[model samples]
Target: MLDYLFAALLGVIEGITEWLPISSTGHLILADEFIHMSTSDAFKEMFDVVIQFGAILAVVVIFWSKLWPFRINRDACGSGVSGLVDRYCRKDVWDMWFHVLVAIVPSAVIGLPLDDWMTEHLHNPPVVSAMLILYGVFFLLMESTVGKRRPQVRRIGQINYRMALFIGLFQFLALVPGTSRSGATILGAMLIGCSRTVAAEFTFFLAVPTMAGASLVKVVKFLADGGGFSGSEVGILLTGCAVAFAVSMLCIRFLMNYVKKHNFKVFGWYRIGLGALVLAYFYLLKPAL
Candidate 1:
């Protein structure tokens, strides 16, 4: 029961932080420091990544119309195969998907090679705190500079192949623990002239494949290393994922509405403050005690 409660709390954290410019993995890591679950280190690690699957489901739910590329058109059915293609296939959505695929390449290429090293060494409070503060400053500076200019890509469709690849390159930077995946790509997109809404939307779309691939990798590695979940562990995992899916629905909606009228400066300040708190707790306050 207590473990389930902890899982729910972490779920809430993941759902909220995953979409925001603030880092979800950073929050989960910090949360783990205090909210120790009665599970092995391996399960805990796998739990953190797989719980994101719930959040991914939320994106699919909210954007199903945009993400799904097929529909039935009876009118075009009579015209044969060419009409079938036109009726059932959404060219725009497919194009968007292709762009998403391109955007994930850089992260896949770089992140795969360094995943183990990073998890072993960099998945610590100090690294997480440093990245939180570093990207926080980047957000502040980015907003003051290119963020003030008129955006060249005001819509997700306006994001060209070059822009998608550039954003994917930035996604590679998120291999660092505290660098939010959404934050890196969104910041990169906005820096290159995408509007805030476009950057946020593209970031959400990009997350579907990026996170799914990452979760699959973690699951495979966990199994390869002889990790197995018990019955209770499965329950805890399900609880976390269910709660994350529910909360993510609300968070994604809120963020979409929030970004239209607001800049990311507030999240920037929040990250810096939270990063300082983590550093103080781990390095200063805890050490003194």
Candidate 2:
């Protein structure tokens, strides 16, 4: 019962933080310091990544029309497979997906090789705190300078292959704990002349594949290591995912609306404050205790 309750709480955290410029993984890591579950370390590690599957599903649901690259057509071009293909193929959507694929390459190439090393070494309070503060400053600086200019890329459709690849390269920075993948890509996009709305939308779209692939990898690695879920673990995982899905729906909607008129300055300040608190707790307060 207690485990389920904790899972729900973590789910709430994930749903809220995942969409925001705030780091969901960083928040989860910090939350774990206090909300220790009955699960093993391996299960907990896997749970953090897998729980994001729910959040990904939320994006898919909200952007179904935009993400789905197909359409129904009553008029036929041919009799069989060719007709079906002609009816369903959406060239624009397919092109957007190709851009997304190109953007993910830099991260996949770099992240895959360093996943284990980063998990073992960088997944800790000190590293998370440092990144939280560092990126918070980056956000502030970008907004003060670049935020003042008229953006060159104001629509999602305007984002071309070169821009997507540039954003993806920045995403590689997010491999470090607390860097926040969305934050990095959105910031990078903004720096490269994308409007706030366009940057946020593309970031949300980019997350679908990136996070789904990550969750799959985590699950595979867990099973490969002989980590099987007991009944309770399964229940806990589902509970967390369901809650995350529900909360993510609300959060994503809120973010899309919020970015239209506002900048990310508030989130930057919040990150800096949270990073300070984490550092003080782990290095100063906790050690004294």
Candidate 3:
């Protein structure tokens, strides 16, 4: 019914913003206001975590072909584990996976505790709005101050483990509700000398693991709580997941090409505008919730 419809709408929002440097979590918080769902605090928490699974699924489905690389060429050979891996796998995919793993560790270590705290007390429009505006300002300053630019790194393979770890460390900041993991990582890559397009693409690739792990953790927590998940609920989740997956594929394709020719300044303006609106709604417009 209407719940299913709302689920789909949220899925679309999650998919598109999840991978973008824009804050998907921030959008989800704001979008929930439009769904007419109960505002009970527990329900709101469940809704936020559950819908993210949809976006996480999008990453898995859209990037499945590249996540695990296989070489059908048969003749490619080496020696030990690396040799056997080389014999059966394309070097490019293997290299990309390594960098992703490297980039994942920092956030994983720092986020485990921080995420719990944020979920407990920080899931509100005011926080999201402030983060969106503050990060937007950072984005604007980054582009203007860092004038040296270079050709895009051709593929994820071009990134080194050192850079990957640095990106992962930068990702820790995203544990704060307002600073985006993608935004922080992208900015870190650029600061370390990656072209904007290269940084964006690498951020997209890394999201598959980072977001998936976070989503799975949430799912496990929900299940462990012993709450019943009805057939209708499952259906709603699947619909959301499907919609997010499909839309995200398109978004990634479009963003990949878009960043090659443009800068992220436009998104900065967008974040600022959205942040201002949230602030207005919470402060100047709406009565206390």
What are the per-residue Cα lDDT tens digits for candidate 1 across 138-191?
Answer: 999999998889999987888878889999999999989899999999999998
Off by over 4 Å in 3: 38-47, 50-65, 74-87, 151-154
Model 1 weakest lDDT span, ten residues long: 79-88
- Worst lDDT run of 10 residues, candidate 2, spans 77-86
lDDT of 2: 0.92
Between the candidate structures 1 and 3, which one is better when assessed by TM-score?
1
lDDT of each: 0.92, 0.92, 0.76
Candidate 2 lDDT at 89 equals 83
Shift of residue 268 alpha carbon in model 2, Å:
0.7
lDDT tens readout by residue for model 2, 144-184: 99999999998788889999999999888988889898899
Q: Model 2 segments beyond 4 Å from truth?
A: 74-86
